[model samples]
Target chain A: MRLVTTNLTFAEVQPKLREVVDTLFKTVPAGVGSKGFLKISVPQFKQVMEEGVKWAVDNGYGWEDDLKNTEGYGKIEWADASKVSDKAITRGINQLGTLGSGNHYLEVQVAHAANIFDEKYAKACGITTPEQVVIMVHCGSRGFGHQVGTDYLKIFEDAMRRYGISVPDRELSCAPFSSREGQDYYKAMACAANMAFTNRQVIMHRIREAFSKVFQRSAEELEMNLVYDVAHNIAKVEKYKIDGSWKEVVVHRKGSTRAFGPGNHELSSRYQEIGQPVIIGGSMETGSYLLVGTKKAEEETFGSTAHGSGRTMSRAQAKREVRGEQLQKAMESKGIYVKAVSMPGLAEEAGLAYKDIDEVIDTLDRAGISKKVVALKPVGNVKG
Target chain B: MKQKYKFFDDIATADAAFEAYGKDLPELFTNAALATFSVMADLKKVAPKAKKKIVLKNPKAEGLLFDFIQELIYLKDAEYMLFSKFTVKVADGKLTATAFGEHINPEKHQLLTDVKAMTLHMYSVQQTKSGWKAFIILDT
Candidate 1:
């Protein structure tokens, strides 16, 4: 999720943002050989899966106030670590704070006051001026989540056969929602979701440390607080009206984000009067946006919106079209500094490979699903 | 004749899928593992500096292939190793293989995107009139 705070203004940190970009690229572990900054044993990894961000905050990585702004207060209630497989635990043990490769990045962006559409709502989320700089960290449960999915696909395949359920494709293999296999997958998924929440929380701590070093001030002095955090690519049981009758159903959001409207009980207290913060990440060469959910979204799209600018080109095509070094120089010419592990990796995520984010956001705005609050232009980026 | 193995651009826009073929089951499994790693890094540049043995058992042939490729992905993420050479043997629903590769040196090796996982979407392993063929999609 992307985060904003009442921190240093753009002018005050422009030069440092450059330095911080390099520092973050080097400081934060990325790619295959990069291990996490903090080491955790299997037991500690289990605790992370169980407690999520609360575990990080309890360990002094972040403050309690940080939780107040996070989704679900940074922990999902249904997470059961016992359901997580040992293979998943082993994959997550050393990857606690590291950002994985391919589209995962830490970016520093500036939100101009003039660009903000809703002054009251934007201010409530801590965006006050054009000079205020924000940080956006995009990542997920990493190998842990992948392993869980792999382990369950095999289980579900067998369960599907046993239940005598057949689908058009093998990929669609699934058991009844009330069955034991279904419940077990849901519990294991919650653990992975919690692991992802903990991942973002720990990365925020690293960002604060990087800022403190560059500005010669503590994180508190900088007022670096989390604006909001959201989860994508997960399933949840949500109550919604169907045929004029309220019913409970599992809302599966893949490549999407939950955009609960004002007064939705799921929102944190600070955002309850407004709406859930919906983060739409753009390519590193392009800029991202901050949005607030609308009642229309709840009525229409099950309180969900697009997660990112949809890809328009394949990675192979992107590599064939542009060189990473040339793309980096172009970004630098536009004042967006980049640090990446490999040039080929960078080429795979070129801006030309994606749709115009401004157009995508405009569709959501014109459609009344989510309203744009502020536009964030990138200043520094650390990519894996 | 079609090549032993090659990648096809997925219509889903971001991922890549591959088809592997062999005259026998073990050869088909070996080719599939090679195709999976090729998606992550250039296989030609990887050196056989180290080797590890992997053993897996599954009641079904497709399950064994899925688990085998997943095991390689796990090693890539957890141990930071990339295997370029594989020798696989399958007998009675059991798979044993010796994989050789070195630790990922970012400076020396120009790594591509990390292959996150093997997907069941369009996953298949079957026998054809010519030989054994398998198709698998990777989540990048």
Candidate 2:
């Protein structure tokens, strides 16, 4: 997930919400078979796999500061393009600068003054004024990641038989982290991670262009600074104090994300005083939250927190309960303007399908995993 | 009577799940392709404007099914194509097929979710009383 704060307020963008959404929907391709604007060759795409957002910035896709705001500077240093398969490269080469379908979205939100929980953290993170307009993008490495996973899962399943390892479920296939197969998968997965960062960075560039076109101002003049970008369901090596000694282990956070607290050396200089920003995206109808990591999380939860409001209902059930067109009309009546490519797709993501986000965040907060900084209510959305 | 395919409501919550049925191996493979593509687009709206051929060999019928669906998804992502109609033949562990569809046009096709990959969770191919049945869970 990634968030960007603009100088414009919600009141300023509300009247032009439809136009803004339309502009974004046109600029950012969504839904099945959505292709990107940039067309790079397979070799050039390999450079992207290794270099991540650096390649984007160097190629004029984004600004230098975008690197700073991104997690791991928007690139995984250990990523190896050679470890990535030809099929994975083929799947990802054309998918940059696009928003994919199914629960992925780009939303325009407002940070109401009453919703601001900690003014100090909010101000530090560029939420200085009431009704501050922000953009949140929820997507990931696209088909490239999926292919990498498919390739490795097959390899690991085969490796398990050779290594005399057994699991009850085939989906839980694994190879020891120290094994060659495991290391190859790790490096290949890093390449996919880089691909995702570059993907979002390229999309961010498109978003900046869209906002500039709609508002009639340069992105810099609009102060479209990216607050932060983070990933979920990723595993990385971290040092944790276990028993009497500090041990380095590969922490696989499925359906969770890193919530490193303040003063942690892992944090970039910009976020050293404050903790890592944890973006918790809720359903499009309900609001989302901006929270900072806590020291307690590092001690108790392996520096991790929840990824999002867990789904309470399945997609088919949601579609059975809600009609997309009716849901759209209802949201418009409730002041949330939305543009969707497919109605059935829209119904599948109805807010009723998700759990109460406030309750989820409250649980995290009470446990000191993260602290609330700001609450953002949706005003406009481009649903994928 | 055997239906071509049907989507399941509770099998996989976050992704898509479906079951495809056929009287034999070839029909089963063809119906599986149909079921997989149906998740990404409306078959009726996707005109068969072009054709492509596929030939794959896997010792296991289940592996062949997985590869067949994976190939379709790969084409969707790599070539920007969606196939609504398929003609498949599976013989002696070798599978060959032809798929027909057009390049996806946002204006022409009622495109839905992109089926990213096939998953191993609850994925199976079995023979029932009347026909061959296969269960698939696609990661969207």
Candidate 3:
């Protein structure tokens, strides 16, 4: 029931998290290049880049406090409107609230504890039913992000060569936090990060409407509430236990999620006992999970864990190798209803193309990075 | 001969450069649009009955060729047609191309991910001693 800005940091909802996660994803927009419920003008879009979820809420999309529970309270500290190019703006103008495609999506799931920890968290999050529905939304900044990344890559790459930085991979090109190039990238990235947060917020509002339309009930009656939200893709300058003095380190979480442990002020006061909630989205066919950050996370991975089941094949390769109709038939057999803008997209995101999420969870758990809280099974899904 | 990159241009829904480079930059940038139209239908069968003189602005010489090919892909996707051949000149992000193509079928073709769009992902244009090279990542 809370807006994500202030209180819900991943800590308090550990118990009922699986149900929360399953229920949440069903509403949020996700999938590679999934479009949003609405569009905004470039000016308004710029506001989104600047204000994050608050901008959407101010525009009548969400609650004022929703930003409180959100990471960075939706607005990134380093966002720079100037850093975004006109082409990026052009690409993003019509796509402000879109989900985009690929692993991004909105899915409905159910959580029942097969394990004690899962059960405990489910109870705490008020997810009492083993068959309770949950939603999961997996997405980033969409085309805006792509453009930002692309736009910045050239700048940073040129800067890298200018500054004489040699990295193993072109994709890994980055500048130091103190450098001018680094500063520019950070500012631009913040803009994208804020847009991503706002994008999810707008998508969540649309989800509420979709639910109300389908179920014929008010959102409040359905008890659709945001459990927690965290972003792991961007890098941040934060206080970490570096040399035990909480030195500032630039933590880059690519394809990862921040798993801040219990007792941090970032979490809602109520959730301080459990820790920040960690959301892990799996492929559409397999399922997802809701977990709590561990104190040990600070030591292992800078309080981060895997983002989703990483892609096993490129989309082009997927299209070249797989068929859409056959892929849809397989999903239907498993009782997961599917709808999409493109059949080829369904084939591209075929469940077989990813690593087993169950195994991924096992590795995370065994690795002691993020502990498992609850497991979700899919019911309905839509992808682009 | 056929590059694996999905797309090179951002908004490719109309008339655009369709580079299909194979062994050389000139050829690769020239044929991308042709390859794109082929995806819509049979390029060999299309009589090139409809011809249009077209040009586009590519931001970079190498990426511009990539963008040209993506433009052809966009046209095919939106028009359900194909363009067989093109001649292009790329400099300082601007591309001028003369393209000839025709309408065709889709069901007979194998459609890949309806590319939502393309953005510079691993987009690079390099010239080797033997030929030209480029890599593109399309958001499917």
What are the lDDT figures for the candidates, one per model?
0.86, 0.90, 0.64
Model 3 C-alpha lDDT per residue in residues A42-85, reported as the tens digit of each score: 78888888888888888888776566667767888778898888
Better of 1 and 3 by DockQ: 1
How would the candidate models be sorted by DockQ, starting from the highest?
Answer: 2, 1, 3
Candidate 2 per-residue lDDT, tens place, A135-168, comes to 9998999999999999998899899999999988
Give a tens-digit lDDT track for model 1, residues A240-285. 9998999999999899998989999877688888898889998898
Clashing pairs in 2: none
For model 2, chain A alone compared with the true chain A gives a TM-score of: 0.99
Q: State residue A149's C-alpha deviation in candidate 2, in Å.
A: 0.9
Candidate 3 per-residue lDDT over residues B1-140, each given as its tens digit? 45622443323321111223356555667654544443333456666667656577656676566456555544443343456666666556677777676654333333223333444445567776656655544444
Estimate candidate 2's alpha-carbon lDDT, on a 0 to 1 scale: 0.90
lDDT of 1: 0.86
Model with the higher DockQ, candidate 2 or 3: 2
How good is the docking of model 1, as DockQ?
0.68
TM-score of every candidate: 0.97, 0.98, 0.78
Candidate 1 displacement at residue A173 in angstroms: 2.4
lDDT of 2 at A91: 86
- Ten residues in sequence with the least summed lDDT for candidate 3 chain A: A1-10
Best by DockQ: 2
* Superposition TM-score, candidate 2 onto the true structure: 0.98
Q: Distance (Å) between predicted and true CA of B67, model 3?
A: 7.1
How far out, in Å, is residue A336 in model 2? 1.0
Interface RMSD of each: 1.5, 1.1, 9.3
